[model samples]
Target chain A: MIYLLLFWEFFKIGLLAVGGGLVTVPFLFDLTEEYSWFDKRELIDMIAIAQSTPGPVGINMATYAGFNAAGIGGALLATLSEVLPAVIIVYYIAKMLKRWQDSPYVEKVLKSIRPAVIALILFAGLDVAKETVVDWQTAAVLVVLCAAMRLYKKSPFFYIAASAVIGLILKI
Target chain B: MVGLWQIYCLFFKMGIFTFGGGYAMLPILQSEVVRKRHYVTEDELLDYYSIGQCTPGIIAVNAASFIGYKLRGLGGLLSATLGVISPSLVIIVLIAMVLRQYMDNQYLQWMFGGIRISVTALIINTVWDMWRKSVVRVRDYIVFAAAFGLMWCCGLSAALIVLLAAGAAFIPDIRRLKK
Candidate 1:
């Protein structure tokens, strides 16, 4: 029964949280109010774990929250339910998109959407900056890393790992 | 032709590397998919992201499934989607079981803080790349400013902003067609 409920809740999240991973955070907050599966503090901890680890934060949160609710089964169920909506919806979108690939209207709309989407991504970056760029040390890290990344083309994993070591050594 | 296993492996690697969220996946995708593999062109990637934003579900997952479908079909879609989430399943479950106790440790917190800064830097780099690739026209600039302002100042949701941009672009097309 809890499995069904978990599926329903996360499935709703997948269906409604259209934008991205962080978009699901608010919905999870509401889950804290509705169910005793995970509390607000635990949610924060889950988010921290999700962000620090590799993988999509949304799915990570879902799995963690699900496990909290009903162990391994709950975790598996929630992850599957969460992705099911995406799998089904994007399948059709991809199918139709192929036909529309050459359409002038699709091209024109995509042309405009390209910039708008970039703006949204930039806005997301600013939001993260607001949270992470708290002091001079952190700001320095961001600036230096940005410059270094632009200069040398390396996999993102390399920089991420390097930053983790820097963080550990500096204890910042 | 790309094999389903290859699709799965690529996304699995992407899942392991991605931090933050879908936006953070952009750089990894740009490096791996566009640059290394040549499976999808840069424009196709942006297209997947744009559509993925408006669609239901996680953006990264949506994009993964989309790319998977384009590459192989239903099998590819399942492989890609499953591949990406597999890491989250294993890692989060393990952490939930054992490492929950250590989550509050000071050293880990400091490490995460540093990791967060790096993720931001990555996002900034992605924005630069997208701007270079996408924002060419004066109209595109206007749309960019409008979308950014609406989201930042007005607190409008991203889906609505995308719809508005698409609608605004569509209007001019209608006018051009009538002319």
Candidate 2:
């Protein structure tokens, strides 16, 4: 029953999280509230884990949520559920590329989705900021990173690594 | 069957090297998969990236699956998916095992603290880039603002919000059809 629920929950996430992985965070927040599977603090921890680790944040959270709720099998079920919609969609899209390649409606729909996706991305940025920028020191790091990105065009990994080092040195 | 090893190696490199996930992986995938390898064209990759965003799974995995399926069907899909996930699986297992002990360590905490801030910046940067490249009209601006406001202020379920937005988008078309 738990596995089925896990699959269904993630399937819905997969089907609807149209923008990307970060866009799923808000939904997962609501999901945790409803399910009692994990609490807000754990969700933060999952975010940390998901961000620090590889793979998509949404998939990582789903796996962790499933594991918390129902162990290994649940984890597998959740992961598979999360990917299933994409797999199916991509498969069909791949099949129909030739037919739909020149469709103006398709182009228009894609064009329309871009703004919504940008909105979703902005929401993700705000959500992460609320969690990470609690203090002035961290806030400074954010400013510096943003400047580096905008002004210098420095690689993001460099900023990430530099911030980690600064955090270690300053104990902030 | 054809050049399977090369494909696996290529995706594995992408999976391992990308630090910020999804958006960050875009350029890397574009360079290695599209420009360097000639596996897919830039337009196709952009389309794949768009579809990857709308679909579930890791965008990297979705991208890999599409590329793989395009190249060699099921076998390609499995290989690409595995390749995309392999690095993360290994890294996460190691971190999960070791991180609990370091949870209280000040250095580790500070390092993660810094990383968290940087992650926020990266996300903002990506968002800005997407907005510049995308959002074209006033309606687009309105939709973007509305969605962001609803999510941040109301803490609404994202799934429901997206559905409402999609329905709202369709309403005009539906009315036009009636006329």
Candidate 3:
């Protein structure tokens, strides 16, 4: 029963968490609130782990959440469930892609989605800001991180690693 | 002669360096797939990215799967997808165990706190980057505000947000067609 619930829940995440992986954060937040799968703080740790690790953020988070919720079995089941929709949908898309690629309606819809996707991305940023930054130290850390964003160009490992070291030194 | 094993190994190496999610993979994709292999064209790679964006999944994984499908059909798709995730599966499982064992260690807690703040910062950067690209012109700004307002105020689910936004876009196209 737990396994079934796991698949169903993650499948819903896979179906709707469009525009990439960060978009899944709100859904996972909803899950945390509803179930004892993990708590609010664990969500923070999960995101940290997800971002710092290799692979897609969505898959990594799903694996961590699933492992916590059930076990290794739950991890595999949840990961598979999250991936199934993308695989099937991509297959159909590849088949009919030539037809839809040129459609004005499709272009319009995609164009329209841009603003909405931007909103979602902005919300994801706000959501993280809300959860963290409880005091001056954390606030300072956030500021430093934003500044450090440029040094790495895009990959965040350097920033993440540097943050961990700073935290250890400051005992924060 | 790019064999299945070679494709798997290339993506596996890419997987290890895929920090900060899909956006971080672009440089790797260009150098490895475009420059070194010459298997995937620049245009094809861009198409994979756009299609990956419109599709529901991790953009990197979606693009990898598409490339895999193009290269070697079903088998290639499976190999590439598995290769991409191999690092996550092995590393996360190991880390999860260790983290569970020491989740409450004092230094670890402090480190996590700091890391969380930085992760939050990185996300904020993503927001600014996306905003510049996505929000343009008057209508786009209005939709951006509307979408943001709807979620901030109404607390709508993701499915609903996607539906309404896409629906709003379709209105003009459908109306024009009818006329």
Candidate 4:
């Protein structure tokens, strides 16, 4: 039953996570609330783990949720289920592209999804900011980072590393 | 078997090296998979990135699955996923066990404080880049605003929000077809 639940939860996520990893965070928040598998604080901890880890944040969170629910097998099922939708969708999308590569309607529909994706990303940024930036110093770091990101074309890691160093030095 | 091991090693290296998670893994994946391994092309990597963005799971894992599936079918996907996850699983489990009692330790708290600040920056950076490249028109802005409002303000389900947006986008097409 737990395996089935894990599979179904992630299957839904995989099917509808149409805007990326960060976009799935809000959905996971809802899931956590619904299932009581983890609480808000644990969710925050999971986010930290997810951010620091190697895989996608969404996948890591799914794995964490599954692990919390029913151990390793649950984790495996959840991760696989979360990815199944994409594998299926991409396979079909690739096959269809050969035939409809020049279809204007398809092109236009994809283009229309762009703005919504951006909005979703922005909302994610705000949600992260609300959770992490609890005080003035953190807010300052966020502002400076956003400015650096906007003005410079350097890799994001540069800013991330710089901010880490600065935060350590300032002891914030 | 050797090829499978090689694929596993390649993704394991990526997993171990990437610091800031999915978005951070992109350049490494681009170099290793596309340039070095020659498993995928530059264009395919970009498409994977775009699709990975819209899909569930981590971008890094999604990229691995997509690339692996392209290269070696189901076996490729399994190996790649395992490789990408192995480092984090081992590390997180160790940390969870050892640091369970010391979670509130001052040094650990300070370290996390620093990391949290850094992660926020990385996330904001991602938002800025995605916005600059993707948000082109007023209609796009409207969609973004609407989606953000739905997700953050109304606390609507993401699934519903996306479905609503897709439905909204299709309305004119439906109308034209009916006419």
Candidate 5:
């Protein structure tokens, strides 16, 4: 039943994750609250790893969550369920390219979904925010990250490394 | 001939090189699909990307699946999808296993705290970026504000918000077309 539920949840994500990969964040965020598949901090780590590693952010996340929840089979099943809809939908859309090509209706709908997705993503950020700020010193890390990101192009690799060192030194 | 092996190899290379997929992977995809294989036109790729955004699933994966299925039916689709995902599976599995060992270490916990803070910052930055990109018109501003308020205050599901926004976005277009 757990395996089936995982597949179903990801499959639904495949069906309605508008605006792109990160939009799936909100769905999985809700899942952590609803089920014990993985927790919010783990999801935040998954995001960091997913962004740093190769592959689509959404797929990496699903794979990580699936691996954590079940095992290898679960990972395979979760990924399969997630991409199955794409194969079906894209297959048909390719066939009917004439009807859908640059369809204004499609563009407008997507445009609208973008902001909604941003809102949802921001909400997910708050979940991570709760776990991230344990003390004033730890809270200081958040302030620094936010400040560094705003100032210049600090490569993620360097940024993460610096943060880890700060954390280790502060022991927060 | 661009056989299954070639398809697999090419996509696998893409999986390895392309970090932070979706729109970020577009240029590489164009080079591989359009310039190398001539599987689809640049215009066609852009079209697929546009539709991919509206459709379910990741845009990059959808684009890959579409191009693969276009070039070689089910075999092409399987090869490409597997190729793109294989790298992540291998890397993430290995990383997860190693991380599992250090899950309780105090030092690692502190590191995770910093990483999570960084992630939160990244996510918030992403929100601002998306907001700037999407909310151009006054009407768009209204929809965006309404969606945020409804979701935050009412605790509505993203699915419901997307559905409502989609309906609202298309209604004006439909009315104009009717006239």
Candidate 6:
């Protein structure tokens, strides 16, 4: 039963997650509220791992969320369901590339989707902030990370690893 | 024609080596698929990327499926898609399994405490980047505000807001097309 639910939820995410990997973050955040498969703290960890790892962050997230919920079987189902939509849509679109590419309808949808995706992503960041930034120490860490990330323009993997080392040293 | 196994192996290799997420995969794909294998032309790779952006899934998977379909039909599509995700599934699950074992370890908790703050910072940075890239036009800002309001004040689901924004975005284009 949980497997079926996990599949359905992730499939819906796959169907609607346009733009790129980070767009899926909001949907996964919604899942933390709707189910106890993984909590918000675990979600933060999942995001860190996914961002730092290889392959697509969205796929990495799906696998992590599923595994947290129901072990290996759940992970497999969640991952497959998440990619099912892409497999189906890409197969058809690949055949008639010119027609679809030139279609005004597709262009309009994409144009519209961009702003909405940004809003959703912003909302997700705030939601995460509310969860993680509890005390002065965490808040300080957040501030420094935000500053460093903006100033440096480094990959996310660097920040995540650096923070883990800091966490161990500071004992916060 | 490239064999299905070869396609799978190449993508699988990509799955392991390419870090820092989907956008990072592009250089590797360009070098391997376009320059090394001649699987697709440079123009075709760009086309796949743009198409992948608009499609409803991870850009990496969508692009892989497109290239695979072009290369060897449905089997190639499956092979490529599977190859791209195989590493993620295996690696994340392994990490999750190990993390679960340390579910109550104090040291692990402290490490994650820091990780959590960093994750929030990363998300905020991502949002900043997205806003800069996406919110160029006045109409786009209106869409952004409306979507934010609906979610924050009205508690509308993200999926519903996306659908409404897509519909709203199409109106101007549709009216122009009618003219």
- For all candidates in order, the CA lDDT equals 0.89, 0.69, 0.74, 0.66, 0.72, 0.79
Lowest-sum lDDT 10-residue window in model 3 chain B: B19-28
**Residue-by-residue lDDT tens digits, candidate 4, A39-137:** 888888877776655455666777777777777676767777877777666555555654674778755555566555555545655665676788898
Per-residue lDDT over A1-172 for candidate 6, one digit per residue giving the tens place of the 0 to 100 score? 9999999999999998885667888999999899999999989988877865667888999999999899999999999999998889988888777467568876666677778766766776677678778889888889999999879866555666688788888777
lDDT of 4 at B110: 61
The DockQ assigned to candidate 6 is 0.44
For model 2, state the Cα shift of residue B33 in Å: 6.8
Cα distance off (Å), candidate 1, residue B5: 1.7
Best-fitting candidate, scored by TM-score: 1
Tens-place lDDT per residue, model 5, A33-96, is 9888899998998887776566778888888888888887778778778888887887787777
Tens-digit per-residue lDDT, B105-162, candidate 4: 6655565566566566665565565567666766667777888877776887544555
DockQ, each predicted model: 0.81, 0.38, 0.43, 0.33, 0.39, 0.44
- lDDT assessment of candidate 4: 0.66
Error of 1 at B81 (Å): 0.8
| lDDT of candidate 3 over B50-102, digit per residue (tens) | 56766787777888888787788767777788788777777778788875556
Off by over 4 Å in 4: A1-58, A61-101, B1-60, B63-80, B97-103, B167-179
Which residues of candidate 6, in runs, are more than 4 Å off? Answer: A1-82, A93-98, B1-84, B91-99, B171-179
Instruction: Estimate, for each residue in B41-101, the C-alpha lDDT of model 2 and write its tens digit.
Output: 6556655765666555567668888888778877777677767765655555445456656
Angstrom error of the Cα, residue B100, model 1: value is 1.2
- For model 4, the chain A TM-score is 0.65
Best by lDDT: 1
Give model 2's docking category.
Answer: acceptable
Q: Residue B1: error of model 6 in Å?
A: 14
Worst 10 residues of 4 chain A by lDDT: A152-161
